[model samples]
Target: MNHKRSLVRRTAAVAAAGAAALVLAACGGNGDSSAGHDGHTSKSPSASASASQGQHNAADVAFAKGMIPHHRQAVEMADLAPSRAESAEVKKLAEDIKKAQDPEIKTLSGWLTSWGEEVPTEGAMDHSAHGADGGMMTPEEMDQLKNSSGKAFDTAFMEMMIKHHEGAVAMAKTEQADGAYAPAKKMAGAIITSQTAEITQMNKLLGKN
Candidate 1:
C-alpha cells in the first residue's frame, strides 16, 4: 500500500510539472505575438507619414514658385474676360480657366508654405525675373487687354492666354522631368495634359489650329 501511494504521488508530480511547462510555453508564445503586434503598430505611422508628406527637391520648389505667379496672372486675365469679352465662348473659357487655376494656386501656395519657402504675393511678379520663358504679360499688354472690350478683347485674351499656357506647359514639363516630389510631379503631368488641351482649343478659337 505504501509503495502504491508513493507511485501515485510521483505520477501526480510528473503531470503537475508537465502542466506547468505547457503554461510557461503558452506565456512565451503570447509574449512573442504581442511583440510582433507592437512592432507592426510602431511601423505603421512611419509608413503613413512617408506616404502623406512625400519627398521634395529644388526642382519642385522652383516649379511651385514659378507656377504660382504664372497661375495668378492667368486668373487675372480670366477675370477680365467675363466683363470685356463679347463672345460667349470666350467668356465660358475664361471662367473655366479661373476655376482650374484658382485651386492650383492655393495648392501651390500650400506646398510652398509647408516647405518653408516663400509664397509670391498676389498680383506680384518680377517680369525681368522670368523673362519670355515665363510667358508673362507686360504691364502694357495687360493694360491693353483690360482697356479693350468686345471682339478685340476676345482676340487679345485668347492670344495672350495661349502664350501664357505654353509657358506653364514648359514649366510643368520641367517639373515632371526634374522634380522629386511625387505630388508636384503628378500636378505637373495634370498641367501638361489640361493646358495642352486648352492650348489646342485656344488655337482653334484663333483660327490657327
Candidate 2:
C-alpha cells in the first residue's frame, strides 16, 4: 500500500510540471515578439474618441469648411499665367499671388488643426453660398482658360481671380463678424488687408489690357 501511494504522488508532481512548461512555452518560446499578458496593441478608447473630436464651434467649422474651395480656385488662377502669358507683369502677378496665398492656405490649415477640425481637403463645397464670389470656377471656364494664350490668358486670369478674391473677402467678413476665436478672426482681417492690396494691383494690370 505504501508503494502504491508513493507512485501516485510522483505521477501528480510530473503532471503539474508539464502544465507549467506548457504555459511558459505559450509566452513567446518560438521567437514571437509579443510576450506580455496585455500583448494586444490597441489605443486607449478615450484617446481614439478625442482624436475625432472637433474643437471648433459650429460657426468656426462653417468658416473653414467654406473657405477651402475658395482658396483653391485662387491658386488655380495664379498657376495659369506661367505657361500662357507673354507679359512679365502677368507672370510676376501670378508668382506674387502664389507666394502670398500658399502660406495663407497653410495658415488656415493650422487653424483647422488647432480647432481640432478636419480641413476641407476635398474641393467640394456648396457653391450656393458664394454670392457673386467665384469661389470655384466652372469646368467650362477652366476649359476656356486652358485653351487660351498671352492676352487672352491674362484677361481670363484677371477676371477669374478678381471674382475669386471678392468671394474670399465675403467669407472673411463673415468670419470676422461671426467667429469668436481670436486667431481665426485675426486671419480674416489679414486676408482682407493683403488680398485687397493684391486686388488693386491686379485691377491696375487689367486696365492696361
Among all candidates shown, the one with the greatest lDDT: 1
Per-residue error for 122 in candidate 1, Å, reads: 1.5
Top candidate on TM-score is: 1
- Which pairs of residues collide in candidate 2? none
Off by over 4 Å in 1: 1-47, 128-131
Query: Model 1: per-residue lDDT, tens digit, 56-101?
Result: 8999999998998899999999999878999999999999999999
What's the CA error at residue 95 for candidate 1, in Å? Answer: 0.5
What tens digits encode model 2's per-residue C-alpha lDDT throughout 171-209?
889888987666667778988997787778878888843
TM, every model: 0.76, 0.67
Q: In angstroms, give how far residue 203 of model 1 lies from its true place.
A: 0.9
